[model samples]
Target: MPSDSDLVTVPARARTSTTTRVAKVLGLLVLAGLVISFPSLAPDSFILSVGVVIASYAVLATSWNFVGGFTGYISLGHAAYSGLGGYGTALLITRADVNPWLAMVAAGVLVAAFAVPVGIASLRVRGASFVIVSIALVLILLLVFQSWGSFTGGSNGIRLPRPFGDDVLRPEQHERFFYLHAALLAVLLLCWWAIDRSRFGMGLKAIREDEDKAQSLGVPTFTYKLVVFVISAFFTALGGGMYALWFGFLDPIFQFSILVGSYMVLMSLLGGIRSLFGPLLGAVIVGYAMEFFKAQYGDTQAHLIAMGALLAIVVLFMPDGIIPALRGLVNRFRPQAASIREVSAAELAEQRRAAEDTGGSERGEKEEVRR
Candidate 1:
């Protein structure tokens, strides 16, 4: 639950204007510009290392956005599925000398297969129980890794000989690693965009609001949820595979760690889980927060403490996340919700005039984001 201060229950209304859409696009551009410029500014290989970690995390957060963000499933074992992808790729590559790219694809398929059973079985649980199941599911994987250490590589886990062989690629490939993450982030963001605008997304909104009501209206609630569950697992595994390759090693504890899963959830929730831009914003904010905190308070546990406090603030004062909070502040000043929904310069004029003509009580002017 969002902290009480953050939980201002803004009544839902249609966005009858174009301002919000334009703002979203502009925000994306700014974020893209910043991401592209970061590696060049920091020559230190370690900062780039952190970027890789953030990138991999961004993928998981975005993928989880499909289920937890959009469908309200609140999956907590996302990292477990991702670990499956990493370990699966590692075993196939180390044991059989398979191509890394091919190994990732195979891992994705296997996880998607595993996801079907989990989805079908877990759909019976809803809300908090559903979230708990996700956590419990990770434990099941941990036990498997521990008890079957002989086959699964135990607690010490798998290792990789860099990309092809060298631990570090040629200097020419420094930005290549960065671009790989940028591209992966693009793919995940695009998937989120596509999913949010589709018919399935409408079903998800319905499910999010009230499952019984949505099912009563003839929505195939179970099938859509299961399909998204499997799809989310597939992408998450792909990310995990990339992550393993990026680090040149893998451990079950590192791959399947709850902290990774928790951070993904926190990032999504802190940025506005239901919004399309939420995961991206959340990832960037948290990523940079970690960097800044590490710089300021890396000596002790102060960084973690500071991070916890910031999260609490988000939960308390900005329950809708920073985007919504900022949007609300902007809307309070301009009240241009109707003028901004569809994103046209002249069309916006007509919208503003219409609002004025109606005595400025444009009840539907607020741009309510669909989940």
Candidate 2:
């Protein structure tokens, strides 16, 4: 017969598992409903535009997390890939008259192709050296695009034809782009969740913990990092392409700016880089704050000042980011629950021996009675 403790623990374990599943399902449903209804609920075109920006940043931050968060590589040059995607989409649409949607996807493929060699070379380095390489990549792209005025429009920037043309009103334009960005964010989140539960994500986490140890365990650390880097570049590029379409403009200075890269890093770090939804939360906070600052202060340095202050506060008070900090608080204050204990090998062996003895005694008694 099972012990009293065993009976209690089993039911507790079952309840915990069931509770987790239900919570996840309900959370997903709530998120889906909010995203789908956001445009209609938005107060005005300006608010909707802000929503679009938040969604864009969310996508970029989430994409960055795949490599920076999961693989523990601090890549500050992701803006280069984003710029490449923007430029690729803009050039194709303006020069070749390709459909905007097709251009966006093709731009992602092009950026991924570009990432292959870069990842192979950069992934070999670690720490500061890798960071420098990443920064250099963005700088180089910025200069190249800035100088190639004939093809890239140089410092004057490239003006893109609107994806939906003049037929769409300003309000409708905001609504459409907001939904488009939301959809992209959904896709990226789905991909992140899928990878987070897979063996590949486990390998990435192993690399994050200790690359040498992971390599010794035959994790193929380089391949995994490179693959994830490429994937990150692809999605980030897509976000850039969409942004270019929405704004109908692309400037190398802004597109490939180190500031843009910093924002991505900041959003991820502020939200809890290790958590799946950390980047999204970070993006919402940072993105909306940015828009608010710009609206209040205009083109001055006020937004930058606010961002710096926010970063300092996060670093000082919530080093693990808001999500992780909040999670810790919840765990700390939540009521204690029963937990199942792990079985030891020695205990298992003893139980087996006892079962064998009981079986033998029963058999002997049966034989004796029969005789």
Q: In candidate 1, what are the lDDT values of residues 1-371, reduced to their tens digit?
A: 23432322222222433556776679789888988987887688777777776777788888888898777877778988888988888888898888988998898999999999888888866777677778988888988886687888898787875665555454434556667877888988888888889998899889988999999999899898888889899999988888777766787777777767877887888888888778777887888787777777775888667767876787687767777776678768853544544445665455556545542333333323321
Looking at model 2, residue 182 earns an lDDT score of 86
**How many clashing residue pairs, candidate 1?**
11
lDDT of 2 by residue, 75-129 (tens): 9888998889999999999988999999999999999999999988888867677
Taking all chains together, each candidate's TM-score versus the true structure is 0.80, 0.87
**lDDT scores in order:** 0.78, 0.88
- Sequence-dependent TM-score of model 1: 0.80
Model 2 ranges with Cα > 4 A deviation? 1-9, 335-371
Point to the candidate with the largest lDDT.
2
The TM-score between candidate 2 and the true structure equals: 0.87
RMSD of each: 9.5, 6.5
